[model samples]
Target chain A: MSGVRVILDQDKCVGSGQCVMTAPEVFDQRDEDGIAVLLTTAPDTGQTDVVREAAALCPALAITVRE
Target chain B: MTSDTVPAFPMARAAGCPFDPPPELHRLQDEAPLSRVRLWDGSTPWLVTRYAEQRSLLADPRLSADVTRPGYPFPAPGRPTGAQKLGFILMDDPEHARLRRMVTAPFAIKRVEALRPAVQKIVDDLIDDLLAGPKPVDLVEAFALPVPSLVICALLGVPYADHDLFQGHSRNLISRSVPADQRGASFRALHDYLDRLLAQKTADPGDDLLSQLVTRVQAGELERSDAAGIGVLLLVAGHETTANMIALGTLALLEHPDQLALLRDGDDPKLVAGAVEELLRYLNITHTGRRRVALDDIEIAGVTIRAGDGLILANDIGNRDPGTFTDPGTLDLTRDARRHVAFGFGVHQCLGQPLARLELQVVYSTLYRRIPTLRRAAALADIPFKHDGAVYGVYELPVTW
Candidate 1:
């Protein structure tokens, strides 16, 4: 269960909101400028697949999903 | 380079691979002529990558997209079969033609053209919402992505409140990394939800797309499942595809500053339409091609494919084939990019295509003319590209004016 991890390079994140769009529960963001920011430092088990998608979905390659 | 060329690029590979398709597809077209590709599922089926061959094959009846009936090529082991084989679009022959025709009336070029004024208003509203906030706005969340979702909801007659549920599932099922095995569940869940919503529409019809379909279906003409099939298809295809186009299309326009300026200065619908085609061709999303199964022994694009073998028509590569377009790799809005298969080809060509095109042309023209200074908020390399999914699209494209 602890094997799941997704690291987002915020510097690389252009806030496409794709990761959040793909897995909203796993990836949430601030409405500061309408872009997403992760709300949870550690995503739950149900979010494992979603996080993987969020990472894969990122256009900037900002997200790195590690399992 | 014979029957065996380099391995065909799988969707997962394309998502992450920093490679372009023209060279890879060209090599296959020249060398393999007819070749096999490894799909998300373990099965490796023959692919037709050349321009003439792909078109020739797409138009051929021997190939089938429906995996429902027997004598079809089912998925191999754990690899994904499409989520419960939707009807009509993936179906062959008269069925595809028949079903596509049902809703085509509402989506005709002229019908969609009439919707342009309304679509422009939607774009303006979303853009206003984005600007109402602050800088570094994620175009995907604020404007580029949600506008299409909202429009489709209104078009389909789905209540605005239900978007969160359906959109969440739709996003998950389309993501490349969600695994082929999981899509079936996500698809079924959505279908079940729509089935109930559709049944309600049958009882209490509205003027939206669902109610219209329900009225036709209850007349005992179109099957209820077929009606539901159309609903499900539109539910997902109606928005996500357009959302991706807007996000990626905007990125493409920004990348080509000259093209962006072209839109800023022109009000010509012809020019806008041509630019939309170029964007569709250049940013073609159906990268894996429409899935089709051969009914019997056949030879296509110069290769021998037997009965029960699968067929794939690499739309993205075909749209980019140098033979089809002069300097296919470069983005030239002025180029006559018509006849591209970004909406797909043959009987199964995208039914929502005209509607999608209308949304694209209007938004592209309006977005730039209103905010001429719109530019990427981050570096191209700084932003990541999608690595997996049923659709090929960018994640988020942030922009600032």
Candidate 2:
């Protein structure tokens, strides 16, 4: 089985909340500036679809996922 | 013209006045075929007001979105000064095309279509919160802002906990008159914050948009900086603009009860799409688009625009053009509003458009269906309209069901 890890291009983050909304299990946001901080260092396999979905939904194109 | 002062561009004057821009331009379309006018920033630009002309100019290769042109009027300071700019919407062909390409895949139909159900769920949840609120509520605060902002949050992999801070900065940055220096700092703040967040994403990857960019960068498809810049651009453009539209569009519906009634009566996506189009045309939240500078001499609308001139495509004005839209002042959602320039045409059209459309489609349809009796709490005239914003939105749109 592959391990899991969450990646974010914070530089490209425009503070849109797509990731946090879809996968709160994997994403935690900084409300002070609307920036998303990945919650789990390496999320479980079950969180992959939500993580990918959040990444795809981001308007800033700021998130990435890996195993 | 007065001794030291030149006449302001008709489009701008119209923006300042509560009148239709096309009619205002029509008064001068012939007399002053082309006029050089000053922007609020003291920079002179060629204001393209006519409908056909504005459309032609946007697609024209001679004009560029690059703010690097010598004497190019950077609307507010702290802008990516001279080639250091990360905001891709301000660039020309190859660069604009390349950077745009990076973020395009996420918004494609195939990609965005999958997000529909999730977006619907968010809308329903938000509506539940709205229903639980005090009798009188400002829809802008209660529903309009959070719905899309949260959706955008979910898509970008940003933690929802941080929305308020970003929302605050976004609100101020979009204002017509925040100081240049302050705007610059805020932008840097956005960048620094994003950088920190991106670093985290890079170390421990997540399957979000940021992670996708990281893969491209690590895979040698894109540079680390390009990925970062795109993230910031998407972050701001994704939610802020839509938030404005949702708020203003709702106000537009409330102002015209008949249109509101029409929307409330149905939940069809196609019908809702039409309503969104009409709302974009009618409200044109971004009253005037970010200015585009002319790269060379170009002729538009039978008027010759000199080289090195700046063009501010006033979309709000184009939407109300009598020549194009019949009964421009009316809010007939059924009007053939697809041709409107609210989204701007050609290469620089909004990159997040599909997502925006999805959000609007979901929000507008769900809103009226859930709050069927939703009505403006105050008279139309009593509601404060945002006239001073770069993207003209209302201060509050109080409603009661």
Q: Highest TM-score, which number?
A: 2
TM-score of each candidate? 0.79, 0.80
- Residue lDDT tens for model 2, B75-151: 55555564246567777867676666666556755467789999999999989988987978988888888887898
DockQ of 1: 0.01
Shares of reference contacts reproduced by the candidates, in order, are 0.00, 0.00
Alpha carbon deviation, residue A35, candidate 1 (Å): 43
Query: Against the true structure, whose DockQ is highest?
Result: 2
Error of 1 at A33 (Å): 44
Put down candidate 1 lDDT per residue, A1-67, tens digits, no spaces. 4737767776444444546545777675443322346667578888887787666445345677766
Flag regions of model 2 displaced more than 4 Å: A1-67, B1-5, B9-34, B77-79, B82-86
TM-score of chain A of 1: 0.78
- Please give, for residues B16-47, the per-residue lDDT of candidate 1 as tens digits: 23325535676676665467766444456777
